[model samples]
Target: MSRHPDLQKFLDRYFMVFLAGYFLSLYAMAGTFSLVWSTYCRDCSREINYPLSLGVLVVTLVTAHAAVVRGRDWGVWMVAALCIGSVVFLLPTYGFRPHMGIFLSIIVVALLALLVLNSKRYRAMRVLLAEYRNKRQVERASKAQRPKVRRSR
Candidate 1:
């Protein structure tokens, strides 16, 4: 039995859907916010765009999630990088400023991402997915190389 059967099931089924949906929803919300704030938001705001920033954030997080779900060690490190980058990108925007509450929430979200990434279930899912992929590739190669046979009718 696998250590993380549920995680493996989800990975095998709709990992891409979850990743894509989460990213698209985040971007859609950010874009909506930008449109609404364009007139009321007078602060310099660094002339930086919020939609793209959040979109990239979603990309990093989802990429990490996918990497982990697919049993890639590189993605494990990426999750950490995403957490660190989230702090760097969001700190100035939400930290030690007027909006202290927002900063805390962002920190919590980053922490949650790291927590999920490091979960035993997630790690187990990664291993299972790697083995499944290897098995599939091997089967495909063998089928392709198999010799054809025909009998007289």
Candidate 2:
């Protein structure tokens, strides 16, 4: 029994969703900024357009939560990169000279990501979860089995 196999389908779907969300958000931000820049936001004002930033932050949080639930290193790093990039991009525009909030959020998010990715028990836990799920699948399959039929002479 492999925990990795057990969760593979779920992880795959989750990853697809996250990737889709990321790209969609990216395009949406481009469109929004273009529109804003053309019309009213040319002065580098209006708070650097934070709605998309907030959305990205929300998605990162969701990814981190999913990583915690699955104990997957891949998920953790993916989200960590997203968060770190966001902070780095915003820091300069936000006038963050030796900013405490910027540094603190990055550290907290990175540390949590590291803990999830490097946990000593994560692999074992995943294996156990897979084994348990496999057993349950087998039991359910057996319980749902149809009786074998014999051919008549």
Candidate 3:
């Protein structure tokens, strides 16, 4: 357990709120994109785009879960990159028009870059995760070094 239990609690609460908000925004953007695609490309074949979009969504969500729930720094970078890619893709598709999906994507990217990345709380969380990881490693090493005693049958 962290020495500052109250800070840990606050961090947990903040992450929970961030996770929920990010999930909802991402889901809404996906739905909006699907609707827009269907509306705009009625006669086009749906063989490639839908599956690609679904894959991206899945990857984004998984990385998000890892970053927020598991406290993995790599996950945070992956999500940030994906979100930036989303914004780029959205802007070209919308032709600079102000669409809700694009706005949501931009907001997500902004929040991640401005609020979450480089924040003191996030750094503290990373330190805590590192400590936990080190502790686990030590435990595993100790267990591996222990010799098993055999009993006579």
Candidate 4:
């Protein structure tokens, strides 16, 4: 099955536009939260602070976007990593709350991560590892095949 040229063009354009907008919103949200709750964050631990949350979100967003743009199949892994990071941060911050909300949020994040991992476009983590390994192997082989030249003064 092939995509219509017009639809493809629209998707290509829309994707970048959507990503840019999404990132911009995240930035705004982070900035707003940081400024508005600066005092609260000051008293809270670093793990629960706005800056750490913002840093993780920005890093994950950029990384996931780059991974998806480079290899569509790798998008899920990026998503999974993001989800995992969210859960880890969340657990520490909210561990005291043995309430329904904390458990539900954790479940949702875990489920979302699982869904991404099992998506049709998903590729196994080993494939990425192998790709890097193969590249290194090729470089090593090429280097070994090259004749070494010695220079004497």
Best by TM-score: 3
Q: How would you encode candidate 2's per-residue C-alpha lDDT over 1-153 as one tens digit per residue?
A: 666774686565455444444443343334333333433444655565656655665676577546534545565456546544544443443332334554445445444444443454444454554566677788989978967789999
lDDT scores of the candidates, listed in order: 0.57, 0.50, 0.60, 0.52
lDDT of 3 by residue, 23-87 (tens): 64465446446545644555766799767867877877676656654656676566555555555
Off by over 4 Å in 1: 1-71, 94-98, 149-153
Check candidate 1 and list the clashing pairs.
Answer: none
Worst 10 residues of 2 by lDDT: 27-36
How many pairs in model 3 have backbone atoms within 3 A of each other, for residues 3 or more apart or on separate chains, i.e. clashes?
Answer: 0
lDDT, candidate 1, 1-153, per-residue tens: 765987577666656544543343343334323433443353537356655655675676677657656556787687666555555555455322434554556556566555655666655656777787788789999999999798889
Off by over 4 Å in 3: 1-14, 17-44, 47-49, 96-114
Better model by TM-score, 1 or 4? 1
- Evaluated at residue 3, the lDDT of candidate 3 is 54
RMSD in Å for all candidates: 7.2, 11.3, 4.8, 9.4
Quick one: best lDDT, which candidate?
Answer: 3
RMSD (Cα, Å) of candidate 2? Answer: 11.3
Give candidate 4 regions above 4 Å deviation.
Answer: 1-42, 45-49, 72-76, 92-94, 121-153
What TM-score does each of the candidates earn?
0.56, 0.39, 0.63, 0.41
Give the backbone clash total of model 2: 0
Arranged by TM-score, best first: 3, 1, 4, 2
lDDT for 72 in candidate 4 is 49
